[model samples]
Structures are given as C-alpha cells and as structure tokens.
Target: MLDIKLIRENSEIVRDSLRKRGDDEKIQMLEELVGKDQQWRQSLDKANALKAERNKIAKQIAEVKKVGGDASEQIKRSAEIPKEIARLDDETIALKTRVDEILMRLPNILHESVPVGADDSANVEVKKWGKPKEFNFELKSHGELAESLGLADFDRATKVAGAGFNYLKGDLALLDLALMNYAINCMVNKGYTLIEPPFMMRRSAYEGVTDLADFENVMYKIEDEDLYLIATSEHPMAAMFMDEIIDEDKLPLKYVGFSTCFRREIGAHGVDTKGLFRMHQFNKVEQFIFCQPEDSWKYHEELQANTEAMFQALGLPYHVVNVCTGDIGNLAAKKYDIEVWFPRQGKYGEVTSCSNCTDYQARRLNIRTGKHGGDKKSVPHTLNNTAIATSRAMVAILENYQNADGTVTVPEVLRQYMGGKEKLGKV
Candidate 1:
C-alpha cells in the first residue's frame, strides 16, 4: 500500500504511475479515495470541535456549581454535544474504511528505472551468460526424457491428482533434493539466515504481502478456514514482521526460505500443463530481505547476483531481463527475471524472478524501523527472489544435460548431494 501522505501530497506522481501501468480504473479509484479522505478529515474536525466544546461546557458547569449557581444549561449543552460528536465519529470511521479499502488495492509506485511498457514483450534484456549448446541428435522433451529414463511417473500422477502434478522417482527424486540442498547452501554461505516458514497463512496476513483480491484465483483456500496454502515462501517470510517495529540497528534482515508451494494456477492457459515447467505443487528455495528504504535497490541487485551465481555453478545458460511496467505486477517497483535455456524448446524459460518492493509491502503490513526510544521512524523496504524452483530447475537440467543414450548427466555441483552419482539412468 502507498503511504496516505504520498497520495494526498504528491497525487500527480501516483497518477502518473497508474498511467504507466495502463490502469485507468485505478486512477478513478484514486480520485474516489481522495474525495473520501477529504470527507473523513472534515468529519474528524467536526468531532474534535464538539469534543472541545463539551470539555469547555463541563468546566463552565463546574464553575457555576462551585459558585452555588444554576448549571443545568451548561449540563444540557454538554449532553447534546456527545450525540453530535458520536455521529461525526461514526461518519469519519466509515469514510476512513472506504479510503483504506481503495488504498490497499492501489498498485505500488514504479521506480524511475523501471521500463515503461505494456507487457513482457517490451522487457529489456540486461545481459546473457553462456551460449546454448549444439545438439547432434534430435532432442526429446524433458517430460519424455524423464519417463523414458524411469525417473518420473507423470501418468500415475495424472490418474491420482489430475494434470499439473508429477511423481519424481529414483534418481530424479534425489536430484530434486540435491537442487534444494545446493541452493540452500549457496544462500547460507552468503550470510542469509535459513528459514522454513509455514506453508499456510491467514487471509489477513496474506493481504499484506499481495493483492489478494486479484490473486485469489491463483491461491488455494483451506475449506472452512481462514488459511490459504502459500503460493511461495516469500509470502510468509515477508509477513513475518507484520505490525511490528524493528530497531534501525537491525536494518537489513536477510533470509533464505524453503517451502513446498501450492498454487491453483487458475486461468494459466497455453502453458506446459503436463510437465515440470508448471505445476500445482513444487519445492522451492526463496531469498527474502527487509532493509532500510535507502538500501533496498542495492539488496535487489545482490539477490539477482546470488541467484545467477547458483545457475552459473550448475552450468546453465541463462540471461536476465528488466521486467516491463505492466508485467511487473502490483508488489514490485522493479523486477528482473532470469531465463534459462532449454535445449528441447530451443529457447529460454524463466527460472527465477527478483523484485524490490520498496516500502509497498511494509506500509501494508505496518512494518517500521525506528530507534529504541526516538520518535523518527519509517516503513522498511522488502524484497524477494527465487533462488530456485526445483521443478523448473529440474526441467532445465533434464533438457540441457540429456545424453544421446537416453540418460541425464547430473550437474557437477549437485553430484555430491546425489551420492556421487554422475548420471540419471534407468533404475
């Protein structure tokens, strides 16, 4: 959520941001909120004046009584003041609620560095890493290769859980774990505290981290409960300090989170529905940080570098793109996506995303930083990056590391974690 003060004072800046995002409806909503806020301020002023008048009348009544004179008139006026104050108070509360509702839905202000564009096609490529390798033989899809090597059971997974699910068998399962361990260690060695956050979260907390109204279709709600299965560990990790104030001395809180994420994938059309590229449930390692606002953009790049390093270690060819305005979504002011080359697809697919949500989430969650006793305080900035989504990483590996003889060579970095195994072949 944007700071109410920012909306009230620098509205044109906010309006321009909305225009850049191509959201006219939100612009109308912003005008509505401004009107409502004005009304709320007027109502609050009336209530406070009535309260002052009542207090003055009480003093007059006491003075009259002390002098042994009539005080009924003042008492009557004071009694009437309470009723007026109460009405105005109720009006102000209602207006404030309406204002907040719209404010919560408003998208974050884009950073000046973010590219102004309508969609992903306009995203600018920052740089490329290793080049795609040449294959001498016709390549099979990752799904076909996995099944052919007896490494996965997609047929059985479909029979039990429908499409968008899979069962990794034998060496494939171990490779998944190895990926997790490798990513986790990569982050841990970089001074990030390891965390295993809850897989389910309350709707109220979830709202602080995402636009729940727009994101509901992508989330799985727990039946008859206030909880929803988390779409990413970043959600819970970012919400960890909701409604709390941290000391300025502890400015940057970096965390490496691990979780099994679940998503409804509603309306995700024309994507890989039968393979590891997209899934209803998957294991992931996430990087999250909470820091002072001034240092957020720096941490944002740091996160991207960390993720790219992991991919580099695994010998995966990839490139980074600066996400355009429209595709950047509501939370991030700016974002970067790391796309890895897939030999079978003859193109790159996104394997990781990094975002810098500068005070947008902190304002919603009421996360602040202040001195122990000083009055100065401000909202902290929040950021998150995909260290690795094991499923997608596996897809990249399966396609890039497939041998001509229907086997997959394990990445050198993950060999130790896979019990020194060099290849994933038929069991």
Candidate 2:
C-alpha cells in the first residue's frame, strides 16, 4: 500500500502515473475519495471539540447536583451529545473505508529508471548469455524426450489430476531436487539465509503480498479457512516479519526460500497445456530481501545478478528484459525478467523476475525497522526474484539439449545432482 501522506501531498503526481499507465478510470475516483477523506478528518476534529465541551458540562452538572443546585436542563442537552458523536464516528469510519479501497487500487509511482512502454515489445533487453545449441539431428521438446527416458509421466499425471500437472519420475525427479538445492547453496554462499517457509498463508497475508485481482482467481483458497496455497515461496517469506520491527543493523535482510508453489493458472486455459512450460505446481528456490529504501535499487541489481549467474552456470541461452511500466503490474516500482530460451517454443519466455517493490508491500505488512524511536526508521523496502523455478528450467533443459535420436543431455551443473549422468536416453 502507498503511504496515505504521499497520496495527499502528491495527488497530481499519482494521478499522472495512473494516466500514463492507462489507468484513467481510477483518477477521478481517487480525487473524489481523497476529498471525502479530507472532510472526514475535519469532522473528526469537530467531534473531538464537541465531546470536550460535553465532558466539561457533564462535570459541572455533577458538582451542581451534589450541591443540591438545579442541573436538569444542562444534563438533558448534554445527553444528546453522545448520540451525535456516535453518528459522526460512524461517518468517519465509512469514509475511511472508502479511502482505503481507493488506495489499494492505486499503483505505485513508476521509478524514473523504468522504460516507458506499452507491452513486452517495448521491454529493453539488458543482457544475454550462452547460445542455443546446434543439433546433429532434429531436437525434440523436453516433454517428448523426458517421456522416452521414463523421466516424466504426463499421461498418468493428467489422468489423476488433469492438465497442467505432471509427475517427475526417475532421474527427472532427482534433477528437480538437485537444481533447487544447488540454487539455495549458491544463495547461501552469497550470505543469504536458507529457509523453508509455510506452503500456505492466510488470505489476509496474501492480500499484503499480491494484487487484489489474484485473490479470487489465481489463488487456491482452502474452503472454510482463511488460508490459501502459496503461489510462490516469496509470499510466505515476505510475510514473515508482519507487524514487527527489526533492528537497523538488520537492514538489507536476505533469505532464500524453497517451496513447491501452487497456482490456479486461470488465464492459461489452453496454452502450454502439454508440458513443463507451464504447470500448476513446481519447486522453486526464491530470493527475498528487505532493506532500507536507499538500498533497494542496489539489492535489485544484486538479485538479478544472482539469477543471471544461475542461468550462466546451467549454460542455457537466455536474455534479460527491463519490464516496462505497463507490464510490471502494480506491485513493482521497477522490475526485470530473465527469459530462458525454449527451443520448441522458438522464443524466450520468462523464467525469472526480479522486482524492487520499494515500501509498497512493507507498508501493508507493517514491516518496519531501526532503533527505538530513532531518526532513521520507517517501513523497509522489499525485493523478490525467481532464483530458479523448476518448470521453465525443465523446458529449457529438455528442448535445448535433446539429441536427434531422442536422448536428453543434462546440463553440467546438474550432472552431480543427477548422479553424474551424462544423458537420459530412451526407456
């Protein structure tokens, strides 16, 4: 959530940001709601003054009655004040609720560094690594190669759980674990703490971490419970410090979270329905950080650098894009995505995203820091990235490393994780 004070002081700047992002419909409503907020505050001030007057009269009436002096008229009028105050309080609460609703829909102000663009085409390709391999014969997609090697079982998976679900069998299952463990180790070596957090989070906590639209359709809410399955390890990791204060010395806290994340994937009705290109559940080693406002940008770079390092180690072809303003959604002030090459798909697709959400999430989650009543204190900034999401990585590995005869070569970094196997051949 944006700071209410910032909204009040810079309404025009906020409105302009919304307009630039093509969120024109929300501009007028923001203005009207802010006006109501101002009126509500004014009425609250008046109500306080009136309550003080009533209290004074009540005290005077009590003394008058004790002395056997007449106090009936003052007492009768003073009794009406409570009802009026109650009415004002109700109005104040209603207006405050409306104000909060508008604020939730408001997007964060774009970082000056974010490139101005409408969609993916405008995203700046900031980096590239490795080259797509050449094949002596036609390369098969990962889904086909894995099926032949008895490494993945999509047919059985669909029969039991429907599409977008799969079973990683034999070496494939081992590879998934190896990749996540290796990613976490890399993060740990860089001074990050490794953590395995809850796979489920309360809906209220989900709201603090994600956009409102995702709550109803993208999340899998447990019936009769306030909790929902996590869409990413980042969700639980980010929520860890809710309503808590950290010491200033702990600024720039970093952690690597591991989990098998679940997602509804409602928007992907029939797309990539065949393979690991998209899946309902997959293992992930996520990077999450909380830091001082001044350090968030630096950490964003560090996080992206870490992701690129992983891709480089895997020896996969990939490119990095600076997500444009419209493509960033509302959460991030600035975001970057790394798209690993998928040979079968014939183009790059996002395998990882690193974003600097600034104080937007921290404000909502109440993640604050610094010395007790110290000058340097406020809600800390938040950042998260896909250190590695197994599903997409699986797609890249299978399609790019496939042999013409239908064997799949494992990447060198994952060789030990695969028990030193050089290739997975036909079953």
Candidate 3:
C-alpha cells in the first residue's frame, strides 16, 4: 500500500506510476480516493472546530455559573455541538476507510530502472549463463522420460487425487529431497537463516502480503477453517513480522524458507499439466530478505545472483531478464526472472523470479524499524526470490542431462546428496 501522505502530496507522481501499470480501473479508483480524502479532511476539520467550540462554551458556562449569571444558553449550545461533531466523526471515519481500501488496491510505484513495456515481450535480457547442449538425437519431454523410467506415476496420482498431481516413486522422490537440501545448504552457507513456516495461514494475515484477487484464483482455502494453504513460503515469511518494529541495527534480515507450496493453478488447463513443471503441490526453497529501504535494490541483485549460482552449480543454461513494468505485478517495484533452457521445448522457461517490493508490502503489513529509541519508525523493504523450485529444476535436469541411452546424469553438485549416485536410469 502507498503512504497516504505520498498520494496527498504528490498525486501526479502517483498517477503517472499507476498509468505505467496499464490499469485503467485503478487509476479511476485513485481519483475517487483523492476526492474522498479531501472530503474526509474537511469533515475532520469541522469536527475539530465543533469540539473546540464546545470546550469554549463549557468554560463560558462555568464562568457564568460562578458569577450567578444565566448559563442555560451556553449549556444548550455545548449540547448541540456534540451531536453535530458525532455526525461529522462518522462521516470522516467512513471516508478514511474507503480511501485506505483504494490505496491498498493501488500497485506500487515502479523503480526508474524497470523497463517500460506492455508485457514480458519487452523484458530485456540482462545476462546469460552457459550454452544449451546440442543433442544428436531427438529429445523427449521430462514427462515422457520420467514415466518411462517409473520415476513418476501420473496415472495413479490422478486416480488418487486429480489432474495436475503426480506421485514420485523411488529415486525421483529422493532426487526431490536432494535438490531441496542442496538449495537449503547453499542459502545457509550464504548467511541466510533457514525457516520452516506453517503450511496454512489465515485470511487476515494473507491479505497483508497480496492483492485481494489472489484469494480466489491462487489460494486453496480449507473447507471449514480460516486457513488457506500457502502458495509459497514467501507468503508466510513475509507475514511473520506483521505489525512489528525491528531495531535499526538489524537492518538486513535474510531467511531461506523451505515449504511445500500449494496452488490452485486455475486457468492452466493443458499447459505443462502432465509434467513436474506445473503441479498443484510442489516443494521449493525460497529466499526472503527484509532490509533498509535504500538497500533493497542492491539486495535484489544479490538475491538474483544467489539463484543464478545455484543454477550454475546444477549446470543448467539460464538467462536473467529485467521484468517489464506491466509484467511486474502489484507487489514488486522491480523484478527479474531467470528462465532456464528446456532442451525438449527448445526454448527458455521461467524457473525462478526475484523481486524487490521496496516497502510496498512492509507498508501494508506495518513492518517497520525504529529510527532511534522508540520515537520514530520507518517501513523496511521486503524482497523474495526462488532459490530452487524442485519441480521445475527436476524438469530441467531430466531434459538437459538426458543421454542418448535414456539415462539422466545427476549434476555433480547434487551427487553427494543422491547417495553418490551419478546417473538415474531404469531401475
């Protein structure tokens, strides 16, 4: 959410930022908020004036009574003032609430460095790592290779659960665990504390981290509970410090969260539905950082670099793209997406995303840091990036490391985690 003070003082600046988002409705809502804010200020001023008048009249009544003069007129005037003040108070409160709701709906201001574009097509590739390996033979998709090897069973999973779910048998399950452990260790070595948060969260807490529309499309709500299964570890980790004020000395708090993410994956019917690429439930290692506002952009790069290093160690060819403003979404001021080359698809697919929200979420969550003593507080910047999503990484590994003989070579860095196994073949 934007600071109301910013919207009030620099509305043109805010409007220009909203225009960049390509959201017409939100721009109109912002205009409405401005009018409502003006009315709220007027109402509050009137209420204050009435209260002041009441206080003055009460003093007059006391003075007139002390001198044995008629004080009934002063008393009646004071009584009438309270009723008017009450009505104005109610009006101000309603207007203020509406203004706050609109502010929360508004997207964050984009950083100047972010690419101005209508969509991902305008995103610029900033860096590329490793080259796609040339294959003499035709490559099969990860789904076909995994099913043939008995590593993943989609038919049985569909029977037990539904479409978009899979059961990993034997080595494939172990590989998932190994990938998670490898990513977790890599982040921990980089000085990030690992946290395992609850898999479910309440609606109130989740609202603090995301837009209202996500509640229906992205999240899975429990049948009879206030909890909804988490879509990413980032959600829980970001909400942990809701309404909190940290010390300034702890300017940068880094965390590596591991969790089983659940998503409805609604509207994704036939796209990568049978593969590990797009599943309803998957394990992921995510990186989250809370730092001073001025340092978030720097930390954003650091987070992206951390994800790239993990990909490099796994020997996956990938490239980093500076996400365009229209594709950046509501939470992040700027974003970078790392798209890994999928040999079978003959193109790059998004594997990890890094974003710097830059106090956008902190303002909504009321996460702040004390400036000095306990007197003043300021919102801290929040960022999150994918360290490794096991499902997609597995897809990359299955396709990129596949041999002509139908064996998949494990990345050297993850071999130790795989019990010294060098290759995965038909068991």
TM-score of 3: 0.94
In angstroms, give how far residue 302 of model 1 lies from its true place.
0.6
Residue 144 of model 1, lDDT score: 85
lDDT of each: 0.91, 0.85, 0.91
lDDT for model 3 comes to 0.91
Q: Tens-digit lDDT track for model 3 on 193-281?
A: 99999999999899999988898788999999999999999999999999889888987999999999999963454434357888889
lDDT of 2 at 239: 92
Q: Output candidate 1 Cα RMSD.
A: 2.0
Q: Count the backbone clashes (under 3 Å) in each candidate.
A: 0, 0, 0
Candidate 2 backbone collisions, by pair: none
Cα TM-score per model: 0.95, 0.94, 0.94
Better of 1 and 3 by TM-score: 1
Model 1 residue runs over 4 Å out of place are: 58-72, 266-273
Instruction: Compute the lDDT of residue 101 as modeled in candidate 1.
Output: 94
lDDT per residue for candidate 1 within 6-89, as digits (tens), equals: 988999999999999999999999999999999999999988888888888899998999999999888877777777787888
